[model samples]
Each structure stands twice: as C-alpha cells, then as structure tokens.
Target: MRVVVVGGGIAGVSAAWAFAAEPDGRPRGGVSVTLVEAEATLAHHTTGRSAAQLIENYGAQALRPLTTTSLPFFHEPPEGLTDAPLLTERALLTVGTVEQDEAIERTLAEGRLANPTITEIDGDEARRRAPLLAPTDGHRYVLEPESADIDVAGLHQAFVRGFRAAGGTIATVTRLDAARANGSGWRVETTTGPIDADIVVNAAGAWGDVVATAAGVEPVGLTPLRRTAFMVRSPWDHESAGWPLVADAEHTWYLKPDGAQFLCSPADETPSAPMDAKPEELDVAIAIERINSHTTLDIRTVASSWAGLRTFSPDRSMVLGPDPDHPGFVWCVGQGGTGIQTAPGAARCCASMALGEPLDERIDPGGLTVDRFR
Candidate 1:
C-alpha cells in the first residue's frame, strides 16, 4: 500500500514515521510512505514556531491522554534516533490574581486531573520559583513539576531520521493541488507531480479544511487561531536559568526563561484564514505591557517575534483518524496548542487506521477520532 502524508510539520512527520516503521524500527511490510511538504524545507510553519513546551495538563480533556502517552517517547527515544535528550527538567508555574480566583480553581482542577502531582502554592513560593514574580500583586501559583521544556528541533528531527532510515521518501516543494478516489485508492495531484496511494493523511495544519474540500470531501470546521510570541532581554540582574515557565492563570500571557533571555506571548487567539501567519506589532506591544504589569521585567525592546496558527475543531480537540464519510481520506489535523506534546500518540492512532494496525493501548480512541465530527 502506498501512503501519502500531506504537510511536513511535526504532526505530518510523526504520522509518516509510524507508517514507515515497524514497532521495532524495521521497515514495515508492503507499505511505502511519502511525506510531501509545500515549502522548500520541513517545519517552516507552525512546527518550527512552537514554544516547545511539554506541559502534560495542557489542552482539551480528551487530549490529555495523548500527552501522557507521548512522555515515554520524549523521555527515551528509539536507540540511535536522537543524539541528545528531547526533554529537560523545567516546572510549569501558573499564577493568578485574587480577581481570577475562579480561573485558578479551574486550572488546578484540570491540571490535577491530568497530573495528580500538581500542587497549589502560595505567593511566596511562586515568587521563589520565578523571582520575577516577586513584586507582582494579588498573585498565587500552582506548580506542575512533571511538565518540562522540550527541545523542539531535536524531537522533530528524530522522527525525520527514523522515517528516512526506514526508506520513506520525502518530497519538498510539492504542494497538493487536490486528491480523488482512484478505485479503492487515491491519485493525488501536486505541484511537482502526481502520487497514487492507497490512503492519504490530511495533516495540513491550518489548510486542513482546504485539503479536504479539494478532495471532494466535506470540510471539517477547523478554525485557525493566531498566537504571537516574542523574545526580550531578561531584565533580571542575576542568572534566571532556574526559573519555571510562568503563565497567567487567566491565560492572558506567559513567559519562560530562554538562555540569557525570556520568551513571552500574549496567548492571543485571533481568528484567521489559512496562510503563513506573521506576528502583529500590536500583539507584541500588548504582550509586553501584560508581562511588565505582572512581573518586575520592564521589557522595552523585542529582540525577535513570530506567529503561528493553532488550528482546532469545533470541540477544540484533535481529529486523528479516517474520515467517516471517506475512509480513504484520513484526518490527522486540529492540534490546537497541543501539537508538539501530543504528536506521538496522535501519529500512532493515525498510522493504525491508515495501515490496518491495531489501536495502540496507550491511546483512548474516544472523542479524538474523526467520527465525532459526523
């Protein structure tokens, strides 16, 4: 069977790796995989622009299972697949003001449900974990020690190496024009050439619905929200590598230590059409103001900034299986904010439905499958 996976982002690469490998890292029988990317290089879009975090309690409730399942892969990747560790120990600190008491409760409840080890902490401890929060008023914090900082590039490359080593073909500068049924299989037209495949995986990020529509399949409602992030010089007088990822309990903004600097975001979720997203000046300015008001850092200049689209379904959960209406058309999109953290389990699920493998024991194929949209 020939499997064509669209998009070369983290989700697409993860799915391709599964199709290209046996559980033991050998080439799977009879299944040939091809990963096609529209850009000149892989992960030039949302995948490359991610904040690169591995917070287990993040995203929709149904999606938390995937995060837990992906931990092992991030912790101990396949032998010789990655030269360095994909994850590093870093805490997730969520703080709230007295006015946001309900938001704090909701965060704690959701976080504890996913990771029972999460603990509520007083303002002093919050400030201790991140000294920048020292003077912030009306703030309290909850700590999820299990969360960590992920090496985004390293993790993405591991899958790429695995896929290539398994004899999978990667086609860049190949934009999918459309795809349609050819008997029991599909004939996909691209900018470079045509590909005939037994199945096609739609991992097209924000272009998910567009790809579906081109293939004569009904479009799933995937709303892409733009999230802007920027870096500012760490205003701390001393080293801050020991700090945790600090996010507002109201979900308004977040900042984390990065080398000698700090990465911050307004957590903006503006509705957007499918395209290459760019950071708006206003979004950057707003994030700076929020970060300044919440912390001791009086950020004045942005070192760099960028934006990426976080696509979501109507329910804000991922769609990761064969489309109910068209079995040949599989849905592996709608990652929202959980793309990097949940890629492994989501990919395994997509590969099974595409390659006729059994469902992975780690994943709960409950509300995440594409059948929910029907």
Candidate 2:
C-alpha cells in the first residue's frame, strides 16, 4: 500500500515513521510511505518553535492517555534510533493567589487523577521550589514531579531516521496542492509532481482544514491559536537550573529556567491563520509584566522571542482516525499543545487506523476519533 503523509512537523514525521515500521522497529514489508513538506526542511514551523516539555497532567483529558503511553518511548527509545535519552528531569509548578483558590483546587484534582505524583504544595514549599516566586499570602501550588524536558530535535530526527531506514521517502519543498479519488486510491497533486496514494494522512498542523478542503474532504473546524514565548537573562547569580517550571494556575504566564536565561510565555491563545507566526511586541511586554509581578525575576529586556500556532478542534480533543465519509482520508491533527509529548502514541494510533488495523491495547484515545466531528 502507498501511503502519503502531509506536513513534516513532529506529527507528520512520527506518523510516517510509524506507518513504515512496527513498534519493535522492524520495517513493514508491504507498505510504502512518503512524507511531503512545503517548507525547505522538516519541522520548520510549530514543532521547531515548541517549548518542549512533557507534563503528564497537561493538555486535554482525551490526550492525557497518549502522553502517558508515550512515556516508555521517551524513557527508552528503540535501539539505534537515538544515542541519548529523549527526556531529562524537570518539574512543573502551578501557582495561584487566594482569588484563584477554586482554580487551583480544580487543577490539583484533575492533575492527581492523571498522575498520582501530582500533589498540592503550600506557599512556602512552592517558593522553595521556585525561589523567584514572590512571597505572598494565600498562595496555592500544585507540583507535577514527573514532568520533564523533551529533546524535541532528537525525537524528530529519530522518526526521520527510522522512516528513511524503513525505505520511506521524504519530499521537502513539496506542497500538496490537491488530491482526488481515483478508483480505489487517490491521485495526489503536489507543487513538484503528482503521486498515487492508497491513503493520505493529514498532519498539516494549523493548515489541517486547508489540506482537507484541497482533498475534497470535509474540513474539521481546526482553529490555530498563536502563543508567544520569549527568553530573558536570569538575574540570579546562584544556580537556578534546578528550579521547576513555574506557571500561573490560570495559565496567564509561565517561566522556565534555561541555562543562564529563562524562557517565559504569557500563555496567550490568540486566533491565527495558517502561516508562520511571529511574536507581537505587545504580547512580549505583557508577559514580562505578568512574570515580573509574580516573581523576583524583574524581566526588562527580551533576548529573543517567537510564536507558534497551537491548532485545536472545536472540542479541543485531538482529531484522529479516518473521516466518517472518507475512509482513506485519515486525520492526525488538532494536537493543540500536546503534540510533542503525545507524538509517539498519537502517531502509532494514526498509523494503525490509517492502515485499517486495531488500536494498540496500551493506547486509549478517550473516544477522540474523527467520527465524533461528523
């Protein structure tokens, strides 16, 4: 079977690799895979811009299972796929003021349900974990000790390497223009040329709806929301690398230590079009203000800034599996902010469903199949 995967982000590469090989890393003999990217290189958009972190209690409830299922892969990747571990120890600390006590309680309950390691902490404990936090009364916190930093580039390359090793082809600077049903297969027209495919997986990220429309398939209302992140020099001379990622309980802003600098974001989700996103100066300034007010880190100047689009379905759960009206048109989009952490399991499920196979027993999508959108 000939399978064509559109997009070259983490989602696309992971899906292509999964389609070309088994979980044990053995190449599937009967299947041929092709990955098409419009950009000059892979992961040139959202995947490249991610503040790569794996938080077990993060993202939509339906996606939490996928994140859990992907943990084994991060802990022990397939042999020869990567020389180093994909995950490094890091923790997430969510905090709020007395006004947000309800939000903090709700988050703690949901987080502990997903991972028992998630626990509530007192104001003093939260301050100790993140010294930069301003000492204030009625502060609440929740810590997810199992969270870690993801080696995004390494993970993406692992999938690329595995796919190439399995005889899968990748076409860079090749954009999918349109696709039409041709008998039992499809004639995929691209910017470079045309190719035949038995199945087409839409992992186009923010452009998911556009890809579907081009293929004459019903678009699944994917909304792309822009999130801005910026880096600032850490003022503290003492060791700060051990500090956990501190975030607002309401997700108003967040700060993570990175070497001599700190990565910060306002956690703003502005609606955006499918394009290369850029950080607005206003957004960066607002983030700095929020971070400064919450912590001792008086961030004044930004070293750098960037933005990425987090695409979501109407329900915010991922849109996976084949479309109800188009069996050959599979979906792997609507990752939102969970794409990196959930890539392994999500791709596995996408490949399985696209090939007409049953989902892996370990993976439960929480009924996030594309059929729900219909």
Candidate 3:
C-alpha cells in the first residue's frame, strides 16, 4: 500500500515513520510511505516554535495515555535514530495565589490521578524550586518531578531518520492541493504534481480541516488557537538552569529556563486562522505583566518572540485514526498543545488504526479518536 502523509511537522514525520517501519525500527514490507511538506522545510510552524517540555500531568484525561506511552521512546529512542538523548532532566512547577486555592486543589487532584509523582508543596518550597517566584502569602504549588525538556529538533530528526532508513520518501516544498477517491485509492493533487496513494493521512496541523475540506471530507470543527512565547535574558545566569518550568496554576503565564535566557509565554489561546503565526505585542506585554506580578524576574525587554497555532477539536482532544466515513482518509490532527510530547504514541496509534492493526496496550486513546468527532 502507498501511504501519503500530508505535513512534515512532528506529527506527520512520526506517523510516516510508524507506517514505514516496525516499532523496533526495522523497515516494514508491503507498504510505501511519502511525506509532503507545504514549506521548504519541516516543522516550520508549531513544531518549530514550541516551548518544548514534557509534563505528564498535562492535557485531557483521554490524551494523557499518549504521553505515558511516549515516555519509553524519549528515554531510549531507536538506537541509530539520534546521536544524543531526546530528553533532558527538568521539572514542572505550577503555582497559584491564595484566591486560587480551589483551582490549585482541583489541578492537584487531576494531576495526581495522571501522575503520582506530582505533589503539592508549600510556598517556601515552591520559591526554593523557582527562586524567581515572589514570596507571596498563601501561595499554592504543584510539582511534577518527572517532567523534562524535550530536544524538539532532535526528536523530529529522529523520526525523519527512521523514516528515511525505512525507505520512506519526503517531498519538501510540496503542498497538497486536493485529493479525490480513485477506485480503491486516492489521486492526491499537489503544488508540484499529482500522486496516487492507497491512503492519505491528514497531519496538516492547523490546516487539518482545510485539508479535509479539500479532499471532500466533512469538516471536523478544528479550531487553531494562537499561543505567543518570547525569550528574555535570565538574571540568575546558571542558577536558573536547575529551576523547574514555572507556570500559573490557571495557565495565564509560564516561564522555562533555556541556557542564558528564559522562554516565557502568556499562555494565550486566541482564535486564529491556519497560517504563519506572528506574536502580538499586546500578548507579549500581557505576559510580561503577569510574570512580573507573580515573580521577581520583572521582565522588561524581549530578546525574541514568535507564535504558533495549537489546533484542537471541539472537545479539546486529539482526532486520531481513520475518519468514520472516509476510512482511507486518516486523521492525525487536533493535537492542541500536546503534539510534541505525544507524537510517538499518537503516530503509532494512527498507523495502527490506518492499517487495521491492534493498538499498543499502553496507549489508551479512549474517546479521542476520529469516530468520536464523527
């Protein structure tokens, strides 16, 4: 079978790799895979502009298993896929003020259910973990010690390497124009030309619905939400390196240490179109204000900033597997903000469902499949 995966982001590459190779990284017979990217490069959008951290307690309950299933791959990736490890030790710290005590407790309960390592700590301990946090009274904090910083580029490259090694083809600068059913397969029209495929996987990120519409499939109500992030110089220098990723319990703002700088975001989720996202000055200013009010960093200037779209299904869960009506049209979009951390298991599940194979025991997608939306 010839499988054509649209989009070259982490989701697309991982899905293509899974379709072409076995879990142990050996090439799979009787199947061919091709990955097509709209831009000249892969991961030019959301995948490239991510605040790359893996927090197991994040995302919806139905989607958390995907993160859990991906842990093994991050810890010990396929031998020849990458030279360095894809994950580095880091932790997540979520804080709330006295007024948000209920919110903190709710979050803590939910977090503990997903990851037992998640624990609540006092304000003083929170400040010790993230020294920049202000010494506010009645502050509540939850810590996820198993969280880590992901090597976003390295992980993407690993999938690319595995796909290539399995004899998969990748076509950069090739955008899918449309697709139509042809007998038992599909005639995929692209910017460069046309190709025939037995299956067409829609992993177009923010353009998921657009791709589906172009293929004459019913839209799945995917909303692309914009998230702004910027970098500021870290005042503590090396001391900030050990600090955990700190965020407001309500997710109004977040800060992560990166080398000599700190990556900060407003955690804004404004509706957006499927296009190249740009950071808004107002959003950055809001982030600075919130970060300053909550921490001692008092951010004054932004070294750099960018935005990315985190598309989501109406239910806020991923839309994976083959569409109910269009069995050959696979859906690998609507990752929301968990795409990077869940790529491995999500890709494997997508491929398994697409090829009529059983899912891995560890991955429990629950109600987050394509049929759920249908």
Candidate 4:
C-alpha cells in the first residue's frame, strides 16, 4: 500500500518511519511511504524549536502513555541510525513559591502518575541542583530524576535515515494543496506535484485542521498556541552545565543549561492562527523579567530567540488513529508541547491505525485515538 504522510516535523518523519518499519525495526513488507514537507528542510517548526527534554511527567494524562511507550525508542534507538546517543542526563526541577502551594501539590501528584520515581525535594536540595536560583523563603521543589535532555535533531534525523533506508520517499519544499477520494484511495495535489496514495496521514503540526479541510474532511478544531524560547549567556560557573532545568511550578518561566548558554522560555500559551510562528518581543521581555525575578542571572540580553506553535485538540489530547468518518484520513497531530517527547509512540499508533494493524500491548491507544473526540 502507498501511504502519504503530510508535515515534515518530527511527527511526520517518525510516522513515515513507523510505516516503513516493523516494531522490531525491520523494513515492512508491501508498504510504500512518502513524506512531504512545505519547507526545504524537515523539523523547521515546533519540532526544531522545542526545549529538547524528555520528561514523562508532562502534557495531559492521556499523552503520558505515549511518553511511556516511546521510552525504549529514545533510550535505545535502532542500530546504525545514530552516531551518538539520543538522550543525555538532565533532570527536571520544578520550584514553587508559597503563593503557588496548590500548584506544587498538583504538579507533584500529576508527576507521580507518569513516573513513580518522582519525589519532592527541599529548597536547599533544589539550590544544590541549580545553584544559580535565588534563594526564596517559601520556595518548594520537585525533581523528576528520569527526565533527560533529548537530542531533537538526532532523533528526527534517525527517523529520516531509517525511513529512507526502507525505500520511503521524502519530498521537501512540497506543499499539499488538496486531497480527494479517487476510487478506493486518494489523489493528493501538492506544490511539487500530485500523487496517489491508499492512505493519508495528517501529521501537519499547526496546520492539521487545514490539511483535513483541504482533504474534504471536517476540521478537528486544532488550536495553535505560540511558545517563545530564547538563548542567553551563561551567568553561572563553567561547571554549571550539570544544573537541572529550573522551572516554576506555575510554569510562568523556565531555563535550562545548553553548552555555555541557557535556553529560557516564558511558557506562554497565547492562541494564534496557524502559520510559521515568530517570537514576540513582548513575550521575550516577559520571560527575561520573570527569569530575573527568580534567579541570580540578570538576563538583560538574548543571543537568539524563536517561536513555534504547539497545537492542541479541543480537549487538549492528541488526535491519533483513523477518522471515524474517513478511515483513509489518519491523524497524528494535536501534540501541543508533547510532540517531541511523544513522537515515537504517536507515530507507531498512527501507522498501526492507518494500516489496520494492532498497536503494541503497552499502549492502550483508546484515549489517544480520533474516536475520543467523536
């Protein structure tokens, strides 16, 4: 069967990889996969603009299972697809103020559901983990030791390499204009050219609903939310590279070490129309102000910054599996901020539903499927 997967972000590439390979990483039989991206390169959007961390205790409860399912792939990827490890040691540390006592409790409770190893740490312990943090009287802390830094580019590249090795086609700078039912399959129109496929996977990041509408299907009501992240000079000791990612329990701001610089984000969730997102000046200013208020680093200037869309379904869970009304139209979108961490399992589920196969026993797949919304 010929399957065309839209969007070239991590999700698209991973979905293509899933369709091209068996669960055991062997090339599948009787399946032809084509991946199309509008940009000249893959992962030019949210996939590339993530915080690059794999924290199981994130996103909605429905998505935590995907994180669990994807752990093996991220921890031990297919051989020869990567030259370096896909993940590294980097703990997630969430701090809280007295005013946010409820938030801290909620985060602790939610975090434990995803990882039983999650535990609370005192302010002094948190300070040891991130010495740059300004000591506060009422500050509380929680640590997810299993959380680690994800090599986002490496993971995406691995998917691309594995898919290509399986004879899958990749079309860059190709935009899908429309799709229509042709016989028992689909005729997809694109800027690069037209193609016919037996199945279509809508992995389009922020433009998921757009892709669905173009295919003559009802929209899934995906809302693109803007999240801005920026890099600033390191203000701590050189060895501070081992510092855990420091974040507010309220999620107002977060900063993590990356080389000699630290990546900071306001964790803003402003609604926006689907498009190539750009960082807002106001958002950057807000992040700097918050980071300065909480940390010893007086971040006055930024080295670089970018914004990406974190699209979500109406209910805030991912929309996977085949459309109930149109089995040929499968959804692998609505990842929100969990896309990078959840890519592997999300892609696997997408391919399984598209090909009428069963997902692994570990993933329930019931909560994540498109039928949840129906």
**330-365 per-residue lDDT for model 4 (tens digits):** 899999989988999889988887787977776777
Pull out the clashing pairs in model 4.
none
Ranking by lDDT: 3, 2, 4, 1
Model 3 earns a TM-score of 0.98
Question: What stretches of model 4 exceed 4 Å from their correct place?
Answer: none
Per-residue lDDT of model 2, residues 162-258, tens digit only? 8999999999999999999898889999999999999999999999999999999999899999999998898874378778999999999998988
- Best-fitting candidate, scored by lDDT: 3
Candidates' lDDT values, in order?
0.89, 0.91, 0.92, 0.90
TM of each candidate vs. truth = 0.97, 0.98, 0.98, 0.98
Error of 4 at 153 (Å): 0.6
What lDDT tens digits, residue by residue, belong to model 3 across residues 232-307?
Answer: 9999987798899999888999999999899999999999999999999999999999999998998888999999
341 in model 1: Cα distance from truth in Å? 0.7
TM-score, predicted candidate 4 vs. hidden true structure: 0.98
RMSD vs true structure, all candidates: 1.3, 1.1, 0.9, 1.1
- Candidate 1, residues 198-227, lDDT tens digits: the string is 889999999999999989988879999999
- Evaluated at residue 113, the lDDT of candidate 3 is 84
Each prediction's number of clashing residue pairs:
0, 0, 0, 0
TM-score of 1: 0.97
Ranking by TM-score: 3, 2, 4, 1
